[model samples]
Each structure stands twice: as structure tokens, then as C-alpha cells.
Target: MKKYIQSYLGLHLIFLIIAMILFLPLLLNGELVTWRDSQFHIARFHELIMAQQNGHFFPDIIKYSGTNSWGYGLNFFYPTYLFYPLIFLWRLTKLPVTSILIFDIIVVYFALWSNFAIVYKITSKIKLAFTFALTYVLTAAIGNAILDNVAVVRIAYMTQYASNIVILLAPVVVLSFYNIIFLHDNRTWLRAAIYSSFAVMLSIPTTLGIVLTVLCMVVVAYFKRQLSINNMNQLLRSVLLTLGLSAAFVFPFIEQRLANNWANLPNNPDLFGANFSTVLMRIFNLSNVLSLLIIGLTALLIFYKKFNYVYKILGLSYIVALLFLYSNLFPWYLFNRELSGALQMTYRWHFMPAILGSLFVAFAVTDLMKIKQKMLPIVSVMLIYLSFNGMMLNTVAKIAMLMVLIMQRTILLHLTRIILKPIHCLA
Candidate 1:
């Protein structure tokens, strides 16, 4: 255990430094960075606190806009389970707005850790695991979607926490299936069922995601012939049990929504959403150069000989899934009109790419270690150009940050050697 601790101490140190560089410096600058929905979310937090004060420990609905005559509440359509614990903590401690900012930061970092766990399960390489985790957090897609100036962004009002929390919980679902389907771990059923229930508690957007992801995994396993009828039966039983476990929220919520159906929502979608790109990109225009790099990297892995066949399939499938969603090839949105309404935006499943794409990138990026050292500079420049093209910085500024990061890592490693060497000598 001591040897194991020493082996990964450097990596943990690097993760801390990286996380600090990304969030701490900007967050500590004493300015709250928020988007349009920030005030609404802050208001929601206050209302939840008020509800707790009124002896309603779990608030079913909160008055919107603070007037009973014009009140609107989202509880029937959305679940706030993800934020309950944090709200309770705030209720007890009475922390300030900075606490909220810190909460967002912690959620994004947890997402990076989640990405790492998923990739590590697939590749089982520590470096690749850390690299993919870092990629998931810092990638322009995730950065734009999840954060604003190091704070989690205001996307879904009170449910902004859902975006990051769901990303963080995604791997647990995948890992659960992998255990039950591939490893045949009997103990994993309890875990799978619980994770499924917790996932459902996250709300409709995530509930849809859970159902889709589980279905996808089941299909993949069926194709691979790794699943028998009994295995499928077991998976279905767990999922059904989750629905039962989730009834406290799900049943009441669904009944309320059905009984009081919004008059504004129509039965027919336009077949294509009004905001086409918004449905897909969610207000962020991904750099074409970056897109190509993502595609190119995925293709390299698809053809790469060293990776497991399963990984290659999974990676390619992820890319294909993105392409379908990004384009109009699939009618999943039109088919699931109610889900589209629940998501309230395009790219409802944006978290999918952030989770699976990291695994794919980890598989592809690890092979770079085998490349000749002389071409390292060229590869480094290419990576910087591809990944950060969306940032809109001048070329020089982009290259400068890349060079600085490289230099900082090098210096940190040298200092780590010096620091640990003295400790080692004493021990």
C-alpha cells in the first residue's frame, strides 16, 4: 500500500496544480462570473433554504418570482435531488455566494475525476487516465458547456448543477453495466440498481439519458455476444427496480405534469427545431479545426492496431453518435418530443460526448508515447492548434500558453524529484 501511494503521488500533485490553474486563480479574483440565469438559480437556492426553515425539509415546489398570484414552480417537471445535499449544507452553515461558486468549481473538478475513472476502467493506464480526465474538464466543449470563468455556468437555472453532476455520475452507470455484462460480478447488481435510482433522481433529462445509455450498452453487448438472455433479464430487473425506487419523485412528478399539462407545449414538433444549431451546439460554435482534430484523432484510434477491438468499436460508435446528433441524420429529437421539451434545448445529450469522447481520446493519445522524440515539438504544436482553436486567442497567445504549460510541467517534475528525494533519504 505504501509503494502504491508513492507510485501515484506525483500524478495526484499534478492534478491539484492543473485544477488550481484552471479554477482557483480566476475564482479567487473576487468577481462573480455568471450568465443570464444566475439570479434565478440564486433565488432558487434561497427559496429552498426558506422551505427548510419553514419545516418543509424537502421542498416539492418553490414559488417563482416571489408572488403567490403569479407563482410558477418547476418541481413537478424537474427533480432537484442533485442539489438537495448542497442546499442542506448551506442551510446549516449559512455560507455566502462564494460558497455557491465553490460548489460549481467542485462539481466541474468531480466531472474530470469521473472522466478519469471511466477511461482508466477502459485503458487501465494511469497516465492515460489522468490525461483523459484533464481533457474532459479543459476541452473547449466541456469548458463552454459546464463553466463560466472557472464557475459552473448558468444553463438550466436551478438545475445547472444537473449538467455537471450527471456528467460526473455517467461513468458509474457504464461501469455498472460493464461489471454485470462483462465481468459477471454478482455484487454489482445492487450497485447498478442504486446508481440507476440515483440517476433517475437527477430529473427527466438525466432519466432519458440513463434509459438511452443503458439501452445502448445492452445493444452493444448483445452484438458482442457477451450477453445471454439471463444477463439481459438481470439488467432489465435492475432497471425496473430503479423505477420502483424512484417512485417517490417520479410518480408524484409525472402525475402533476400530466394533470396540469402545460397548455403552451404542442403535440407536434416542427420535425426540425427552430433553432437548428442551438439544438445541437447550445450557443457554442465549435471551431472547425478543432472538430477535424477530434474526428481525426477518433479515426486514428479506429484504425490503430494496438487498441482492443472493443475500444475501437466503442470509440467509433461514440463519434458516429455525435455526428448523427450534430447533423439531422437521426430523428431522436423529433421522436422524443417530450424529452426535447424537458431538456429545453438542443444537444440535450451533450454530456455523452464529454464522457465517451474522453475514453476515445485516451486510447488515441496514449499511442503518442511511442512516437520518436524528435517530432515531439511538432506534435505538441499540432495539439495546441487543434484543441484551443475555439478560444479565439491570437495564434501567438495560444502557442505561448501551450509552451508555458509544457515548461511548468517540466519544472514541477524536477522540483518533485528534489522534494521527494530528500524525504526518501530520511525514510
Candidate 2:
């Protein structure tokens, strides 16, 4: 029991340390950085704080704090329950900016923990789990949410979209689903439903993304002959419960749509085109090391034969489906036209790839570390150089530098084995 407690504390301490390292710039600067949607998030946060202070516990109308105090029923349309933690901190600190910063740290730490938990559950290797978790967190997918310091030059911000919630809870949802289906653990079905409900509450697009991911895993499992009658039954139960638990948001969301006049709706052909273009650009761009690493390793995992069933199903096939959905190849035009109200933007699909891609990259790295080939050291060095280059070029300097240092230590240790091999051979 003491050993268990010590191990748990040590693992979480590492997660906390890494999260703080990622946030070092913002913490030192003592200010919240805005990018793309952050300003809108800040506005909504202010409105919530105002509403709470005014004694309207459940605000029906968002007080337009900046203008003539007009009210809009945004809370009815969008879920703000996920931000309650930040709100609680805001109430305690009475410092909105500090509240956001603290909230970001909390999100990052949990995200790391979730990623670590998923990887560790699969591999049962502490070192591999930590490495994969760290790599997963450093990717551009997650950087879009919490890594939006002044140092990061990318159009990074996901608060209004609540991708941070996706980042924190997606892995948990995936892990629970994995347990239910692959492990045949009926106990995890409810856990999967609960986490999936929270994910959908934050973003319906997240719900779609997770469902698609689970479908991919389900397909892979079926093909592998690992899926069974019990697995299918458990999956059905979990999905049903997920829908039931999410009814709170789903019912109102549907009612609002049904009651409202639908004569006019959003039409953005250019935005649809831009989404495809953005995915291509982000993938090909040399500065985006995280995306490139994910893309590269995902391709490798799909082709690489050595990865176990979990890595192949969870990492390879899932990522392929996600990238396919994100690509121009997917019939986004027809899909969007049919269900225009369902998704605000198509790029929301990137959430899953950013997440699952990280898992695959960790899988690739872990497998590479296990190989006995001496040339592996040279390969590791090249990867380190490219990763370092990506970090420096992309302006995620401080966080990247810390990650690079850790990678360097690991790679250099492997390189030393190569260096000593000649000496031992000579002896």
C-alpha cells in the first residue's frame, strides 16, 4: 500500500512538473495570452463571473459586460459547466487573469495524466508511458488549446471551442471505451458514458470525433477477431447511456433549433475550402514539428508490422480515419450541407487526430527504443534535430527546449551504447 501510494504521488508530481514547464512563460509573464478565440473566451468568462456575483446562480441570459448590458442566452446554447473550476478559482482569488492561468495549469496537468493513464494501461511500462504522454502533450493539437503563450506563434486558442476539455477528457473516454470493448470490462461502460457525456457537453463536435474514433477502434477490433458478442453488447449499452446522460444538452439544443425560425443559416463555402487547406498546410509546414511528427509516425504505424494490436488499432487505424475525415477527400461539402447546424466548423475534427496521433507517436518512439540496431542511434539523433528545429522554428521555444533536453538525454544515452560497442568489440 505504501509502495502504491508512493508510485501514485511520484507519477502525478511528474505530470505537475511537466505542465508547469509548458506554462512557464505565461506564469512568469503574469498575464493571459490571447490568440484567435481567447478574447471571446475572456469575454464569456467575465460575463459568467458578473452573473455569479449578481446572485443569478444559473444565468439564463449572459450579461453583455462590455456594451450596454444587453443579455444573450448563450448558456442555454453552449455548456459552461466545464468552466466551473476556473470560476471557482476566480471566486477564491478574485483575480480573473490568475484564475485563467491556474485553470490552464490544471487542464494541462490532467491532460498529461489522462494521456499517461491510457499509455500506461496499455503498455504497463512506466518509462514508455511518461515519454509518450509528454510527446502527446507537446503536439500542435494540444498546443492549440493551452500552449498559446506569446512565445507560440501559431494561431493557438481553443477555449471557446472547449478543446481543452476535449484534451483533458478525450483520453479518459478512450481509455474507458478500450476497457469495455477490448478488456471486456462491463464495469467501464458507465464510466465511458459519463466521460462521453461531459465531452459532448463541451462540444458536439467532440462527441462526433469520439464516436468516429470508437468506430475506428471497433472496426479494427472486429477485423482482428478480438471483438465479441459481449464487447458489442457492452459498446451498445455505453453508447445508449452516453446519449441518455447527454440528454440535458441534447434536448435543449434540439428544441432551440426546432423552435427557432430556420429560414436563414450559416453559409461559408470559403471556410470549408479553408479548412482543407489549413489541414494540408499544417501537415506540410516544416515549422509544425508536432503535426509533422504525428503525421509521420502515424504513417509509420500504419505500415510498421511490429506494433501490438492496441497500438495498431488505437494509434494507426484511428489516426488514418481521422486524417481521412480531415482531408479534402472527405465529402465535407455534402455532409456540412445536410447537417449545417451540427458543426460550426469542419476543423474541429483535428481534435481527435491531435490526441490519437500523439498516442501513436509515443508507440513508435517506444518501439524504436526497444530495437537492438545500432543505426537506431543515428535515427534518434536525426529525429531529435528535426524536433529541435521544429520547436525553435515554431516559437514554442521554452517548452520545446525543456522537452528537447529530456529527449537529448535519452537519445544521448542510447548513442553512448553505440560508442562503447566499438570499444567492447575491440576488447
Candidate 3:
């Protein structure tokens, strides 16, 4: 009990420091940081409010363009349940948009904390958990989809999309994979099922991304004789539950696809056209040092040793991630019309592999430390720095840094209530 207490409080203290640093710029500033999609997200939030006020009772379609011709569009099909809690808050109290925005940021903090918990559960190591969570929270999650598209999800204040990645997407992939691979007891299946059902609401693209990654993982684990019938059963149950829960949104998507609503969705060469033969060169030349280190460490688990099924699964997952990341390199478009169109934007599947890569790195780092490798801490630090603010060449990066420095020094700025509210909640 004492040890657990110390660990929990210590985690909160660490989290507090990081949170303060992250919030410092916003605290000093008088306005919100409107990144690429930030302003558009704010408009969507207002549209959500409008839909709710009309007594729609948790609307599926959010049509703000007033263009009935856009025909219910993404607002109807796309998932926005991540914002539902804010909607509930609006109903309970007349909270203004600024307050809601602040809460959105706070929710992001909470979700990142949850991410740490997932890592801790996997590795059973404190430092490893903190490092993984810190690396992910501070950095751009992997270069999922495209590097620039990363900002649309992880940053730029698209709260729901961001929440989907770190909060729901990360946990769903890692937790379910761990449970399926290690735990054989029936006692845990019910809890797993409920979680699987609930979290599938994050979004279809991300859900499918994880699902596909796990499917490949399951096959790999089984062929290697690491997974038994019971383990496969557990995995299947969770997957079925996820599909069942997401059917509300997913079925509609399937129907539209069947009607060829996506027939015109082209596999644009400019967007994803990279040859498979060039991936090796890209890895050597253009990959992040952190990701390279991650792949190296995990690969060592497979090549340098034998029968390390855990690392084997992770190794296969890394390959799976790369495959989806560069899916346009394949000839899938020549056959399977539905699949080709559904997977037209293969980079979207990068979400699952990103979480998998994070897990592999976290696990690999912890394992290396166990072996007392030299300079490991320095390596981890370098990776942490690189993972941050994905696009370094952009003007937004310069402006964001300038804003943070300005706000960090302006400690006595005119913002007591905004800062104090979260502090009070933390206390």
C-alpha cells in the first residue's frame, strides 16, 4: 500500500510538472493558438451545440454548411462522441466556449495519463511507463498517414480527432493485444468485452486501423505457436464486440461503399505513391532516429535470440505498420474493389502501427535497461526531443515556440481563473 501510494503520488507530481509546462504558453496568452484546423474545429463545436439544442438527443449528423446537398455528409457518418461530454457539460451548466475549450485541453491531459497507465500495465516498470508516455505526449505520435496530417490529429486543437489517437486508439490496440496474448483466464473476458465495445466509438478509421493491425498480429502469434485456441478465442470475442458496437456507424459506411459512393475515390499517386523498393533507402535516410532505434531494439529481440514470441509479435507489428504506412506501394488496387477504395488512403491505418511502435520502443528500452546497457538514458532523451512537434520546418513551429516563451515569462498575466480552475481540480 505504501509503495503504491508513493508511486501514484509521484506520478501525479511528474504529470503536474509536465502539464504546467504544456499549459504555460496558453496561460500567458490572451487568445487560443489557432493552428491549421483549430478554427474549423471551433466552428464544429458550435455546430454540435446547435444540433444538441434542437433536442436531437446525441445527433449523428452535424450539418453546418446548411447544404442539404452535401447530403448529411461527414457530420452524419463521422464519429464525434469524444465531444459528447462537453455537450453534457454545456447542458448541466451554462459554460461558455472558452471554458469548454479549456476542458477539452484538460481531457487531453487525462487521456495522455491513461496512455501512461497502458504502458505501465504492459511493462510493469515505472521509468519505462513514464518515458513512453512522456515521449508520446510531448512528441508527434508516429508519422502516421502523412507527417503534416499528424498535426491535424495530434495537435492543431482538433480535440475529438486528437482524443481518438492518444486516448482511445492507443489503449484499444495495446491493451487488447496484451490481454489476448498473455491472459488465458476467462475471468477477464467480460471486462475486456465491455471496454472493447465502448472504445470502438472513437472513430471508424482508427478502429479499423487497430483491428487490421491486430488481425495480422494474431496470425503471426498463432503461426509461431505463441497463441493457443483460448487466446484466439479471447481476441475474437473482443474483435466481434468492437465490430458490433461500431456497427452503428460502420454499417452505414459499408452501405455507402457498396453503393459505390466511394467509387470515385482514387488512389492518388501523389498522395501515397512510393515504391516498396525505396522503403529501405527511406528508412536509412529519412526515418526518425527514435523510430530507427525502436525498430533496431525490437529487431534485436528477434534476430539475436530465439523463440521470444512477445518480440516476434511486436516485430511483425512493426512490419505491419510500415506496410500500411506505404500501402500504395502494393498492387491491391488491381483487385478487391471495395477493399481498395476503403483503404484508398492507406496512411490512415498508420494510427494502429504508431501505438504498436510506441509499445515496442517502451518494451525494448525497459529490456535494455534491465541488461544495463550504457548511454541508454541519453538515447531515450534524444528520442524524446525528436518526437516533439513533428514538423520542424513549418512557420507554426516558430510562432508556437515564440508564444510559449512569451507566456512562460509573463507569469503575472491576467488569467487567474483559467489557471486556477485546473489546479484546483488537480488538488
C-alpha local distance difference test of each model: 0.54, 0.60, 0.53
**Per-model TM-score versus the true fold:** 0.68, 0.71, 0.66
Clashing pairs in 1: 279-346, 279-347
**CA RMSD (A), model 3:** 14.0
Better candidate by TM-score, 1 or 3: 1
lDDT of 1 by residue, 94-135 (tens): 764556655655565555565555545555676666656654
- After superposing candidate 1, which stretches have Cα over 4 Å from the reference? 1-17, 64-73, 92-94, 121-123, 140-160, 182-191, 223-225, 233-237, 240-248, 255-318, 372-427
Model 1: C-alpha RMSD to truth? Answer: 14.2
Residue 365's lDDT in candidate 3: 64
Q: Which ten residues in a row have the lowest lDDT in candidate 3?
A: 144-153
CA deviation > 4 Å runs, candidate 2: 1-6, 63-77, 140-161, 182-187, 215-229, 240-268, 273-280, 294-323, 371-427
Q: Ranking under TM-score, best-scoring first?
A: 2, 1, 3
Report the Cα lDDT for candidate 1: 0.54
| Residue 232, candidate 2: C-alpha displacement in angstroms | 3.9
Name the top lDDT candidate. 2
Clashes of each: 2, 0, 1
